[model samples]
Target: MARARSEERRAEILRAALEVIAERGYRGASLASVAERVGLTQQGLLHHFPTKEALLIAVLEERDQWDTGGAGLSREAWRLDLLEPLVEYNAMRPGIVQTFSALLGESVSDGHPAKDFFTERYATVRGGMGAALRAEFGNRLPGGLTPEQAAPLLVAVMDGLQYQWLLDPESVDMPGAFRDFLGLLRGAGDGPRG
Candidate 1:
């Protein structure tokens, strides 16, 4: 019973932490703020996460596998199972997107706890997206752009688009952008498609 209760409290704190961090940048976030978000005391927050860094790292780690086993992240193909679920998740949990964007800004310094995590994550995500593209257009792409060369560029485009969409929600359609980006990756048509 005690273990279950502890786990529940930790989950509560993590959910509240996501909101707090997303609303207020990492530098602006504090244990006190998190506690207020979830109606806990600052000391209560500390019981689960001894420090801000601990909480931040835990949140990021949890996000890593919260939906694990649902998506096969690989360097060969994209199971619609994987990308579609992420698309669904993004719609269901806009907070996750906000939290993810917040962390990208926070994960700059090599000494920052979140830096390495984001770095590796971006690498894997970029690689996976690239690999999926290569599978779709291995022989058709002009000059045979390798996955290694194309993956990072695709990820960069997605990241840049994410920023713009966040700033002007009405100005951008994420799914449409993703579809167009995928087309570009496969050396398909140049302009937007319906």
Candidate 2:
């Protein structure tokens, strides 16, 4: 029972931290603010997460878990066709997407605590994308690019689409745009319809 309460408190802290991070990018967010949101002192928060970085890592992992349906994804679970639905799902959760985008943008600058994490994450994602593309399209896609060449493009488009959608939700039909992109990957003429 005590362990359940501890876990519940930790979950509460993470939820509070997510809101803080969404409103204020990782670098702009502070332990004090997150602690206050959870009705704890900074020192008390430290008892759950020894450092701000630890909390950030926990938050990121939790976000991924949510994205992957909490099943703890394996590489084989990734598929090119699944991206459209993922983008659509993301559209429903602006706060989580905003936090991830803010952190990703901030992490590009040097010395950010999340820099290393984002770097590693991109590498892993790119590799997985490459594998998924190869599995679906063989060594090369219909567009004449090798799966290796296309993986980064795929990652870039998805992330880029998220940025555009976040910036102008009214003008950007993100999932549709992504489906159009997939059409381009397959071949033209089947361009984005509506």
Candidate 3:
């Protein structure tokens, strides 16, 4: 069970790192802070992660794995129905959402470690979204815009809603707002039906 214990410790470190990153953003979070959270010395933490960048990458990948339901990632188009549930799921995990938002905001600058990761991730996410839109609406999604055009908007809405919800959770109904956006995606004047 040595391997099992090692894996558990690593997961604990990642959770601690997420909390630190959520509080301090990627640039400000230090390995010592994460190590202390996991009851380890800084050198001990280094033994596991080697470097802060490696730990950050692990945290990001873990977040993605959680988002994708641990099925690894599916390149195929996501079903339109899954979007709302995903948003609702996100609402239940405020820490993860905050960490993601914090990293995304910080990654906009030049040469950030996460800059390339987010850039590549968005391209893949956009492609999946475009495929989903095309599968649902064929060449053009009711508004005369192609799926390629709408895909980025879809990503924007999801991330934008997260930012709004993070700022004022009491005011932003993230899942509901996302459902409304999906309606807009489907067609104008096609608001959610009872």
Candidate 4:
């Protein structure tokens, strides 16, 4: 019972942290703000997460778990077809997406705690995406580029679409745009090469 209660409290804190991070980018969010949201004092919050960096990492991991349907970030979990549903799912969760975007933007700064995590994550994602593309399209895509070459562009489009959608949800149809991108992938090679 005690352990369950502790786990519940930790989850509450993580949710609060996400809200705070979404409202204020990771660089702007403070531990006190997150603790207050969860009805805990800073000291109490430290019992679960010793440092702001630790809390940030936990929040990121929790978000990944949710995205992966609690399967975590397995390479096998990502596929070309699965990406559309993921984007659609993201469209329904603005707050989570906002929080992720905020952290990602701030993570590029020197000495940022999340820089390594994002760097490593991108490498993994690129590899997974390349594998997925290979599985679906064989050696080269319609655009005459290998999966290795196209993987980064695919990641960019997905992330860039999120930023645009977050900035102007009324105007930006993220999932639709992503589907269009996939269509481009299929049809791009059909046209004559320059």
Candidate 5:
């Protein structure tokens, strides 16, 4: 029972931290602010997460869990076709998307705690995307590019669409745009080009 209570409180603190990070970015967010949101003192918060870096890692892991449907990490989890649905899902949860984008933007700075996480994550994601493309289109895609060659563009389009959608949801239909991109991928062989 005590363990359950502790787990519940930890979840609350993570949610609070997510919110604070979403609004302020990780660089601007403070441990005290996160603790205040969950009605705990800073010292009490440290009892759950020993350091701000620890809490940040937990928050990022939790976000990944949410994205992966709580199944933990699996190589087969992400595919080209599933990306549109993921974008649509992201559209419904602007706060989570905002938090992710904020962290991603801040992570490029030197010595950011999330820099290593994001770096490793992108490598994994790019490899996964390349495998997905190979599975769907064999070694080469319709545009005559190998899966390895095209994987980064796929990642870029997905993340780039998120940023555009976040900045102007009214103007950017992220899911729709992603679907259109998929269409382009599929029809790349049929079009004339320079």
Candidate 6:
């Protein structure tokens, strides 16, 4: 019973943190606001995370974990894995998607927490997406293009598409878009002409 309560409180805190961060960019979120969201006092929240930066770091790590869900994912196959979840993730939490997009800009600065987070995150995801592509179309791509060549663009498109969908979701056909992506990747043997 005690363990259950602890686990429940942890989840509540995590969810509250995500909501606060999603609503307010990483810089704007206040501990007071997050505590209120979870019915805890600021000091109470402090018991869980000692400082705002630490909490923000926790939030970023949690988002990455929640986003990836521990699949021991190969960087090469990350894009394929992201495919089924991206549409749902975008529809359910456009704010989170927006927050992630916004963080990319911030990550350019030296020593930003998200800088390391995204650097590792992208490396992992890129590797997984590349692996997935090679697995599916190893023989279908250009003589030299390889899955690595196409992985980045495909990821960029998906990320960009999320922004577009957030602006006008009705314009996107989520599954069909992914299907077309696969088709293009499969036909990459023809590759893009010079």
Q: Whose lDDT is higher: candidate 3's or candidate 6's? A: 3
Single out the weakest 10-residue window by summed lDDT for candidate 5: 185-194
lDDT of 6 by residue, 1-194 (tens): 98898778877887888877777755567889889999999999898877776676666666666566654444532546557666655666766666666677677899876688678777777777778778766834643468888768777877777767766878876545665665566554333333
Candidate 5, which segments miss by more than 4 Å at Cα?
Answer: 1-8, 18-30, 50-54, 188-194
Q: For each candidate, how many residue pairs have backbone atoms clashing (under 3 Å)?
A: 0, 0, 0, 1, 0, 17
| Tens-place lDDT digits, model 3, residues 1-194 | 99999999999999899888767765666898999999899999998998786787788788777777774345573666788888999898776677678778878999888788889889888888888889989999987789999989999999999999989999988988888888787787655545
Question: Candidate 2 residues 12-129, lDDT tens each?
Answer: 9999988887687656568899999989999999999987767877888787777767743456657887778888888887766776787788788989888898888888788888
**Stretches of candidate 1 above 4 Å error?**
1-5, 19-30, 37-39, 67-81, 84-93, 130-143, 190-194
What order do you get sorting by TM-score, best first?
2, 4, 3, 5, 1, 6
Clashes counted in candidate 6 amount to 17
Off by over 4 Å in 4: 1-9, 18-30, 51-53, 188-194
Residue 185 C-alpha lDDT in model 2: 82
lDDT of 5 by residue, 1-194 (tens): 99999999999999998888768765666899999999999999999998787787788789877777785445676767677788888898776677677778978999988889889889988888888899999987887788898889888998899899989999988887877777677754333322
lDDT of 4 by residue, 1-194 (tens): 99999999999999888878767765666899998898899999999999887788788889878877886767776778788899999898776677678778978999998789889989988988898899989999987889999899999998999999999999998988888888788874234222
Candidate that beats the other on lDDT, 1 or 4, i.e. the better one: 4
Task: Quote each prediction's TM-score.
Answer: 0.71, 0.82, 0.81, 0.81, 0.80, 0.70
Error of 4 at 29 (Å): 6.1
List per-prediction Cα lDDT, in the order shown.
0.69, 0.83, 0.84, 0.84, 0.82, 0.70
lDDT for 127 in candidate 3 is: 85
